[model samples]
Target: MAWTTIIPATALHDLIGQGAPVLVLDCEFDLGDPARGRSVYRAGHIPGARYVHLDDDMSARPDGSNGRHPLPDPAALAARLRALGLHRGQQVVAYDGNGGFYAARLWWMLRWLGHEAVAVLDGGRQAWLAEGFVLESDDPAPVAEGDFTIAPALVGGVVSADEVLANIARGDLLVVDARDPARFAGAPHPLDTVSGHIPGARNRFLRDNFDATGKFKLPAELAREFAMVLGETPPDKAVMQCGSGVTACANALAMEIAGLKGAKLYPGSWSEWTSDPARPVATGQA
Candidate 1:
C-alpha cells in the first residue's frame, strides 16, 4: 500500500504556496466522447484543479443494466469524496489527459477507499503541459465542502461475476489482461462483443505501465516492467481485467506504483467477462 507516481511538474512544484492535504484530481476521460471531458474541464484547469466526471464523477450510472464504470457505491463514494475536498488525511493527486488514463481511476479509487495518500499524475495533463507548468486559466476556487470518510477498503477492491467464475473453476486463478496487443490478440475489440481474451488471460499491456515521459516507471523500473506479466506469481493471486473496468484500474494502479502487490479488480471486467455466451473466448495469442 505504498504508492506514488507523481510528476505534474513535480506535482505542480509540490503545490506553489504549499497546501499539503494536496489534492488535484481531474480524471479527464472520453471513452467515445462523453461530453468531451467536461468540455475540456470548462476550457481550463489545474490551479487547485477539480473536475472529475468520468461519466459523472468516476462512474455509477450504468442503468443500461450495469458494468460500465460500475464500482461507485461506498456510501456513494464517501459522499463523492466529501463533496470533492476529500479527507481521512488527504494527499490525493490524480490526473488524466490520456496519460494516466482517467487518472488511474482516481488513483485506484483513492486506495480502494482506505485512503493511503493517493498519487498518479505522472504525465497527466500531458506531463503538466509538458512541464512548463502553471496552467490554471482561472476556474478553481470552489473547495471547502469537504469532510470525506468511507473506508471499508472499498469492499477490498472488488472482483465479482461469481468471483470470476469461482476463480476460473479453482485453477487458483491468475487472469490479468489489462488490454491491448490488439485487444489481447483476438483483435478488434473497439469496445467489446467479440474479439478475444479471457480464457486463462495474460497479456498485461497497459502501455507497459508508462515511460518515455508519460511518467511512472521507477519502482525498479516498474519491477522490471511487471516482471513479464508478473511471473513467479505472488501478487495476491492476481486478477485484473480491462476494456470496462477502466484500464484495469490502470493495471492495478501500476501494480501499486510498482511496489507490486495489489491486484484484484475485475469489476464486471471485459464487460462481465464478455457477457457470457456461456463464457469462453480466447483468440490468437492469449
Candidate 2:
C-alpha cells in the first residue's frame, strides 16, 4: 500500500536509499521571508531532494481575494511535478523545517491533483536532523521528466467561502479553524488587518496535534481528541480552515493520519473570509 498521509524520517531515508521509486521534496518555507526557504534548502537538504518553493511551486500569486496562498493551477503544478520526475507508482515525501506546516500543503496539493501516493515527512527536517541523518549540500543531477497527468475530476478536496457561509447558516457542517487561540480570538492582528474567526467555526489549534517534541501525537490519541471535538459529526461533514489555507492542510493531514477522512478544506479561510466587510467575524473561543 502507498504511504498516503505521513511518513517517518527513517522510513523516508530507507525509501530513498533502497525502497521503491520515490521522489523526496524539500518544502522548507518561512511565511515571513519567502526567499529564506530556498536559501535554506540550497544550504543543506536531504540527498536527492528537490526544493519546492511555496510561492513558486505550491501556491499562486495572491489576488487579494483568493487568500494569501491560493492553490496553484492544476496543470501548472502537474507540469512542475512531472519535471521533478514525479510519475505513477512513485511515492512522494514532502518535508520542511517547520513541523509539516508547509510540507502538508504540498501533500494536499498532490492529492488534489489526483495523486494519492504522497505523504508529509513526520517531524519534518527537524526529526531528520535529530535522527543523526546526513545532509547533502550538493545539488543532484537533473531528473528526467515523468508522465504525471492532471486529473481535474479529482478536485473534490476543497470548499468555497460561500459554501462555508452556507454551512454556517445551515448549522450542519462542523467548521474547524487551525489558527492559534490568540489569532482565533481576534487579538494581535499580525498577518491580517482583521482578527477573529468564522462566526460558527470551532478552534482546534494545529500545534495541539503535535507533542512537546514536535512530532505528531499517536494516531489513536489524535482520533480520540478529534472525536471529542466532533461529537456526533461525521468526518465528511467537517471543513478545515486556517489563516490562508496553508496551515489548514496540516489539520486535514492530521485527520487523515488519524483515520478520520473526507474533511474538506476552505481554501479561502480567514484571509478571504475577512476580505469582505459584510462577513461576520466572531472573537474568542468558538
Candidate 3:
C-alpha cells in the first residue's frame, strides 16, 4: 500500500527492511537559524536519508511582493528532485524534529508536483530515535540520478492571492490560518510586516493537529475537530494558509488524514497577503 499522509516509525523501519525502492529525506530546520538544519543533518540522521533545505531546495528566491518561502519554480524543483533520487513511483518519506512542520512542506510540494507516493514520517526524527533506531553521522553515498517527471497534480491545487482576495467579497471559501494563535490574533509578528490575518480567515494552529506524543490525532478525532471548525463548508471549498505557507501544509495533511480531502493551499499565504498595503488585514479572533 502507498503511504501518503503519515507513516509510523515501525512501519517505515519494516518498509526499509523489505528492500523497497524508497527515498528518505531529513527535513529538520530552524526558522531562526537557517544553517542549523544542515548542521543537525551532518551530526546525525536516519541511515541513508538525504537532507533537504527549506530555503535552498523547497523555496524560490522571494522578491518584496512574494511571500517569504515562496513556492519553488516547478521546473527547477523537478530537476532538483531528480538529482535527489526521486523516481516517479518511489516511496518518499520525509521527517523533521519539530512535529511534522518542515517535513509536511516537502510532502505537500511532492504532491503539488503530482507525486502521490510521498509521506511525512509520523512524529518525525524524534520518533525514529525513540523507537531505538540508530542515526548515522556519515554522509550518504552518491545516488544515481532519478527519472522522476512532473505531471498534472493528483491532489489539491494552489490558491492564488487574487482568488483569496476575491473570496473576501465572495464569502464562499473558508480560509483557515495555520499559524500560532498569537500570530493569528494580530500580535506583532517577527517575520512579516503585518501582524493580523486575512479578513475572513479562521485560526487553526497546526499544533492542534497533534496529540501529546506529537503524532497526529486519530482520523475520526481529527474529522470531528475539523467538522467543528469547518461548520457547513465542505473540505473542497476550504483554503489553508499560514505565515509563509509552511505550517499550512500540516493542516492540509491533517485534513487529508481525517478523510476530508481537497483543501487547497495558499503558498504565498499571509506573507504575500500583507506585502501589498491595500489588501485588508483583520486583527483579533475570527
lDDT (tens digit, per residue) of candidate 3 on 142-218:
98899999988856788899999999999999999999889989899779798899998898989999999999999
Error of 2 at 105 (Å): 0.7
Q: Which stretches of candidate 3 lie over 4 Å from their true place?
A: none
Candidate with more favorable, higher lDDT: 1 or 3: 3
Global lDDT scores for all candidate models: 0.73, 0.87, 0.92
TM-score of each: 0.34, 0.96, 0.98
- lDDT tens digits by residue: candidate 1, 151-269: 65631367776777776667566878878878778868557777888777788888877778777677777777777776877677788878777788778877776767657887678
* Residue-pair clash count for candidate 1: 0
Assess candidate 1 and give its lDDT: 0.73
The root-mean-square deviation over C-alpha atoms between each candidate and the true structure, in angstroms, is 16.3, 1.4, 0.9
Q: 156-256 in candidate 2: lDDT tens per residue? A: 37889888878767987888999999999888777987988898888889999999888889999999998987889899888889999999888888888
Candidate 1 local lDDT, residue 141? 74
| Candidate 2 global CA lDDT score | 0.87
Against the correct fold, how does model 2 do in TM-score? 0.96
Clashing residue pairs, candidate 2?
none
Ranking by TM-score: 3, 2, 1
- Best of the candidates, TM-score: 3
Residue 273 C-alpha lDDT in model 3:
91
- Candidate order (lDDT): 3, 2, 1
